[model samples]
Target: MNVPTVPMLFVEIEGVLRKTPDDLGRPWKGPFDIEVFPDAVERLRLWKGAGGRAIGFSQQGGVALGETDEQTAVRTLWTVRERVANLLDHVVHCPHHPEAAMPDHARCWCRLPKPGMLIAAQHEVSLRQQERYPLWMALLVARSPEALQAASDLGLDHLHGDAWRRDGGQ
Candidate 1:
């Protein structure tokens, strides 16, 4: 019997920031700085080398309203992506508002509390690699327990909080 290799390491963006803005709604106003999770990155590399894949990643902070083009979001995520290219096979983002009153944003599947992004990534990877290998497991990384619980309720694989260090201090 062959053991199936699955994706590992889900890095949460935004909330992991070393600095927090007074207003969460508007974070791009000032010069924002973010710290990378070195330990998580290392783990990701190992998983990738072992034929593991990154099924899901979420941006807990920063609200991106409306159906903005993917380019805009990709640019914002590029910074995070650069740190874990080897670990990450794909990225999923929620560019919608959580509340219904926010018509400009509206309800969408990409949101964190929802598993649409993860599900989509899973399908993408399965289709992309089905000819070569089988998918056994998937992981989700969120900034809060709420997000993790939500992912679990949605049938997502192991969900974890945002905390990454090269030395595995946490």
Candidate 2:
């Protein structure tokens, strides 16, 4: 019997794996604000146990809002990564905001709805590694419409929370 190669899982960090801060109370300044959703973590574990890799895709617009910096954003993601340990393979974030005052974090294509980060991840985790998984078999677990659309454009299967939408909001 031939076992199929497991596909990679693309997860949205904020909102899906962790709750976004309701108020601007020291957001992403430290690891204190990080909270890993138990449900999401469990699901991620299942994927990992199945020989799959999981990558986090987050749109960290707080850097543009002046609430945080690239380092802070990375630290926060690392905190979450520590929680899940081996279950999570990598985490990528976008710091761009269209209206950001800082040019460094402004108007980058890597932001959600553009597919830059996802494309980067795709290249980073070579598709050839997962021999049994094709582009359409790659899975994305995110609640954001932009992520859903990006996955759709990339010909991937997407799940929003617990609901699986194959049509991809076409």
Candidate 3:
């Protein structure tokens, strides 16, 4: 991967790459079943084919809420990655919720509303490859206002989930 020249795409798994929402607007209760949006795989393919590195990120507070365990939550991430043809370069999720029942998950930096996960991804890429990626060369693809806020905080370019999928994450 041309880590320096190509841009980075930070994708939100729920409501963007996958169809986990039901009619009530709540995500699937648990991570047992996984489903990818119809065009997500092709869109990701095009994004990667264009030399853009992709990272999957999400807010899996279910772990903190006692709805699921850390292992199960991570397993869902893997399932989504495989369903998308294994195109993602990295995947991260914030299992913490501010009012989480689990004390360990009550506070965290990598949560969606926070830019920690985004920063971690960029920082890791920079360190591992000894290459830097300017904020302009990165894009956060998601629909949530919280996610957009996080992108803005990091000065990373961003696009709505619909627009990105339509434009192949351009």
Candidate 4:
């Protein structure tokens, strides 16, 4: 009998960071924040050994309420890296403000709800291994329902609302 190996799970940050209040809403406190639950780390180790890869991640809110776009981007990336360093094969950051007053051309492609980062990661992985899974799933753990839907529209198999409390079951 051939036992089907479980597919690797791609987790997102932001909503998986901590249970904090923000523009969207409150997320469950992730295991990384408290250090009490080893679930996050354990999951990472499993994924790394099994050749799993996280697709993309973005800040929960568009920076703080009044913080500059640059500040928010920097802080968000730093936080994300620190939190998911164990499981993440690669990370991407979107420096543009979703509500910025700039022209559309000025925006970058790393933003959530967009598949640029995921696409890039998938390409990189494929180049390295030359193996393509039947289903290429990209999980987005943001608070914006709109953003989730956008990602879904972009052909991602999974779009998670929040990663903190999410259980990507086998």
165 Cα displacement, candidate 1 (Å): 4.9
Say which prediction, candidate 1 or candidate 3, comes out ahead on TM-score.
3
Could you give candidate 1's per-residue lDDT for residues 10-95 as a string of tens digits?
44554542223532434553222434555556756665687666643554324544334556666656656665563466666666
Per-residue alpha-carbon lDDT of candidate 2 for residues 1-170, written as tens digits (9 for 90 to 100): 46465577888876677666742344544666676667677778777787777788888898898877889888888888887654677788898887888777787879888889987775576654533446665788888899989888877888785453223223
| Candidate with the greatest lDDT versus the true structure | 3
lDDT of each: 0.53, 0.74, 0.82, 0.49
Q: For each candidate, what TM-score against the reference?
A: 0.65, 0.80, 0.86, 0.59
Can you tell me which runs of candidate 2 are displaced by over 4 Å?
1-5, 22-29, 102-104, 127-133, 162-170
Q: Mind giving the per-residue lDDT tens digits that candidate 4 earns over 83-119?
A: 5554555555555556655545236565556666556
Pick by TM-score: which candidate is best? 3
Model 3: per-residue lDDT, tens digit, 1-170? 55356678899998788885662366575555677886878888988898778889989887888878999989999888888999988888888988986677898888877889888976776676666667788888898899999988888888898888777655
Clash pairs detected, candidate 2? none
lDDT-better candidate, 1 vs 2: 2
